[model samples]
Target: EPLPYSAILQPGHTLGMMGGGQLGRMFCHAAQSLGYKVVVLEPTEESPAGRVAEYEVVSAYDDMKGLDTLLSYTQAVTTEFENVPAASLKYLSSQIRISPSAAVVAVVQDRIAEKTFIASQGIPVAPYAEIRTIEDLEKADNTLFPAILKAARLGYDGKGQARVKSVAEAVEAFKSFGEVPCVLEAMLPLKKEVSVVMARGFDGKIALFPIGVNTHINGILSSSVVGVEEIDPTIEKAAQEAAIKIALGLNYFGVMCVEFFILEDNRLVANEIAPRPHNSGHYTMNACLSSQFEQQVRVLAGMPLGSTDLLAPTIMLNILGDSWFAHGGEQAIEPDWASVLALPGVNLHLYGKAEARKGRKMGHINIVNKDPQQLIYYARQVSDILH
Candidate 1:
């Protein structure tokens, strides 16, 4: 039986967030905009979200006092990152409810468990094998070639992943990543990378945002465009179905992202899962009826769900502050904001932070276009000028 709204959460109440990154900041804005309070549990004093949230607990994840204080006010808790320390989550789970609970977090935290779950669900994934030692790496030899070595835990933003193109590279890459448990996956010659970001409310109501097409540069997400240029209904259906299954199977009440690789045959093979609002879905803010952040708030607040339909075809360019060209500067290197703003349908969001580093995400820009190709060209131009 489905749980009642009152049993799950209350509106105009507080939602506690586990991490204080930019995602946290956007989620706080969404929650606060809708008349809900937010409590940010962050490790850094200068956390972007913590700076703006209603109540800020600037302490480690294990800070009992901070956790206790947050739980006292918030009706439910959620997270912006999947790498939260399970011990701290366990501590809080014993006291207050954490939606998309600890089990989902634990399962997604380890690459092995994630792959196992995907396979058990009969979902198609890249051919992969596990590695715990040099011997295990050798066993992966005949299984898959042109593979990637990935850490089983705590890896994101393209870190802890190394591509092995040749026989000797596999041996060296495994050793390079050291004694950590790992998974080696066959590299697919993908036609395009797209992702589905969706939210499942406590009422078992699932709303899916548009699928996003992602492009990467030097192992980092450089850009994401929403709504497949030539709407692949088959792909779209499969992507949304996968998200629904994952969210319901996880018994979740929050936003979740599943990245997909469009095989040459047009089949959708999942790349990975993100248990929070994803960078690829940033386009939703300008293109959708309701942003993913707001959808997350709605879900966690046990409120009516938001529409997932895209209002316009949109393109998003990430502002990685640490780009060697311009983003790496400690001080802000202002983009030609006037020029960018002059462009029709352009929306810019800059995260207010003191310092900028190499490859660190600072902000993003969105463009809703009647012509996606033209928008892509202009976006590249603006992003090039910005970086």
Candidate 2:
């Protein structure tokens, strides 16, 4: 159980964060804006969040000394990424108030458990089979072919996944993945990819932002657009309802993003759930009354949930490190920020990473306008400059 709202919300109270990625960096900004100090626990030195946090505990996720040090600094904690060791979160939860609890993280971090849990809640997920050994792959259903074999853990951004058309291919891929536990999911005809970002409070209140129409390039999220006109009304309502159902089922207590696949038949199939504020929800930073990161802080601090109203039709473009090599050179060249900035309704946010590598998420640009068409127009202009 978490501490009471009054105990956690005292002025100048420090909060602890579990990861130091770009998400943590934005989370630090939100926490600071709310008059709370942040401490980050990350093994890496000079991590994005570490740079912004008031203190950084330099230790591995499961390091007891580091966890102890973090507990000493803050009574409330939250994780920036789901991959953090569940044991570490469990240990921390014993001493401090943690949102989305260790149990939730444990369930969502593994593909097998996550899919099973979602389906058990009466939510629709793509047909999938668990592959723990070679026999499991051989015995998988024939209809599951033309499917994606994904490692059950530590896979993200197109990694640890392969498309297989037969049991032989699946076996090969499974061996290549070091025979790890995996899930074989049937691929569906996806008409569109959409996601809903919602925040649930300790009081069981849920606030969902508008659904984001998403696109992917090289299996990585390329862009997400949120607007009243972008999604069908029926699809939007179903997506929101499914998201709320999953939150309630998990008893989730933080900002979570549920990505869904809208099929050609207009059926909504849940793809996956991110236990933390997600990349797709980054648009909320500039277009909503409260950003997802701020909502995360509110949940962690036991504060009342904030409004999730969208203030404008917005498009968020992910700026990958590939942009730096657009000219094809050994040295990375910066994109023309002047041109991108000159465009109306362009909100540029660059993650302060020291180096640029292809496919790395350097930052994002949020283009907002009253006209939906203009939002799309501005997004293309920004892409032209960045690419």
Question: What local lDDT score does residue 61 receive in model 2, on the 0 to 100 scale?
Answer: 99
Evaluated against the true structure, the overall lDDT of model 1 is 0.81
lDDT of 1 by residue, 106-199 (tens): 8888999988887677788888888888888776656588888888988888899999886578778777877689888888888988888988
Worst 10 residues of 2 by lDDT: 2-11
After superposition, candidate 1 runs with Cα above 4 Å error: 1-5, 8-11, 322-324, 327-332
> What lDDT score is found at residue 363 in candidate 2?
96
Alpha carbon lDDT of residue 83, candidate 1?
88
Give all candidate RMSDs, comma-separated: 2.6, 1.3
lDDT of 2 by residue, 7-122 (tens): 54754899899999999999999999999999999999989999999999999999999999999998899998999999998998887788878999999999999999989988
Q: Candidate 2: lDDT over CA atoms?
A: 0.91
User: What TM-score does each of the candidates earn?
Assistant: 0.93, 0.98
- Best TM-score among the predictions, by candidate number: 2
